[model samples]
Target chain A: QKEVEQDPGPLSVPEGAIVSLNCTYSNSAFQYFMWYRQYSRKGPELLMYTYSSGNKEDGRFTAQVDKSSKYISLFIRDSQPSDSATYLCAMRRSNFGNEKLTFGTGTRLTIIP
Target chain B: EPEVTQTPSHQVTQMGQEVILRCVPISNHLYFYWYRQILGQKVEFLVSFYNNEISEKSEIFDDQFSVERPDGSNFTLKIRSTKLEDSAMYFCASSEVDSLRPGELFFGEGSRLTVL
Candidate 1:
C-alpha cells in the first residue's frame, strides 16, 4: 500500500461553502501531519500543521489528525475564490533525526465565485 | 519576512546534459532540503543538508545527483546527466530547526526543469 493516500479530487464548490480535504496513511509511525496549498506552477505553501492525534486551527483553516485511524483532514470554512488550489497532505515520523516528509497526491479544488 | 529564493525559474535542456539549480534559503535557517515534483505527482524528497553535510537522502537521490552548499547563502543541486524523467519542478526549502519541527520549513517558488 502507498504510505499516504489522498483523493485527487478536482472537487468544485461554490463560494462560502465548507470544504473538507482528507488523507489516510499506512505508516503508524507518522506523528506530525500538515496541509499545504499549491497554486498552478507554484510551490506548496503550508496551510495547517498538527502534532499527534489532535486538532489545530488557524483562521479559516483547521487541521485534524487521528493517529488510531491513520487519517488526517483539513477543513476550510467560508471558502473563497482565493482558496481555489491544490491541497496536499504531508506527514513525518517522530524519529529525532528523520526529516523526510511523505506527501500524498494533492486534491485540486476550485471555488466558484 | 525572509523567504527562500530560487534561480532560473524555468530551464529546458536535452537529455544527458548536466543541469544545475540554485537556491538561497532563509538567512537564519540551518537545515536545507531539496524536493521535486513531477507533473501531476506528489512532491518527493531528494535530500536534506545540515552543517555542510548530507544528513539524509531518499532512494531517488542516486549517484547522478549531488548537492552543495558552496557558500554561506547558496545551496545548489546538480544533475550529472539528466534524463527525460528528470524533468520536474525542483523546490528548495529551509528550516530554523531540524527534526524539532517540520512545519517551520519554508519553500521557494521552485525551479522548473524540462529535459527533452
Candidate 2:
C-alpha cells in the first residue's frame, strides 16, 4: 500500500458550501501534516498545517489530525470559486531540517458559482 | 511574501540527453527540496538538501539524478540521461526552518520538462 492515500476527487460543490478533504496514512511515524492547494500549472501552496493529533484553524480553513486513526482532514468553510484547485496532503516524520515529504495523490476540487 | 523561483519554465529535451533544472530558494531558508509529478500521478519526493549536502532522498532519486547547490543562491537538479518517463513537472521548495511543528514550505512555480 502507498504510505499515504487520498481519494482522487474531482468533487464539485456550489460556492459557499463547506468542503472536507481527507487523507489516510499507513505510517505511524508521520507527525507533521500539511495541506497544500495547487492551481492549474502552478506549484502546491501551503494552506493548513498541523502537528500530531489536533485541530488547527486559519482564516477559513481548518486542519484536523487524528493520529489514532492515521487520518488527517482539511475543512474549508464558505468555499469560493477561487478555491477550485488540487488539494494535496503531505506528511513527514520529523520537523528536522531537510526531511523528505511523502505526498498523497491530490484531490481535485471545484467550487461552482 | 518571499517565494521560491524556478528558471526555464518549460523544457523540451531528447531522450538520453542531460538536463539541469534550476531553482532559487528563499534567501533565508536553510532547507531545500525537489519533487516531481508525472501527469496524473502523486507528487513524489526527489531529494532534500541542507548545509551543502543531501539530507535525504527517495527511491526515485537514483544514481541518474544528482543535486547541487553550485552557488550561494541556486540549487539545481541534474538528470544524467533523460528518459521519456522523466518528463514531469519539477517543483522546488524551501522552508525558513525545519519542518518541525508544522512549518510551511514555499514552492516555486515549477519547471515543466518534456522528454522525447
Expressed as tens digits, the lDDT of each residue in A1-113 for candidate 2 is 88999999889999999999999999999999989899999999888778858889999999999999999999999999999999999998987766777899999999999
Give the chain A TM-score for each candidate: 0.95, 0.98
**Chain B TM-score for each model?**
0.95, 0.95
**Candidate 1 residue-wise lDDT at B73:** 97
Once model 1 is optimally superposed onto the true structure by TM-score, how far is the C-alpha of residue B112 displaced, in angstroms?
0.7
Which candidate ranks first by DockQ, i.e. highest?
2
Can you write out model 1's per-residue Cα lDDT over B14-86, one digit (the tens) per residue? 9999999999999989889999999989999999999999999999999999999999999999999999999
Write model 1 residue lDDT over A1-113, tens digit each, in one string. 99999999989999999999999999988888889899987788888878968888899998988899999999999999999999999988864553878899999999999
DockQ score for model 2, please? 0.72
Clashing pairs in 2: A95-B99, A95-B100
What TM-score results for chain B when candidate 1 is compared with the true chain B?
0.95
Predicted structure with the largest lDDT when compared to the true one: 2
The true-versus-predicted C-alpha distance at residue A10 of model 1, in Å, is 0.7
Number of clashing residue pairs, candidate 1:
0
TM-score of 2: 0.96
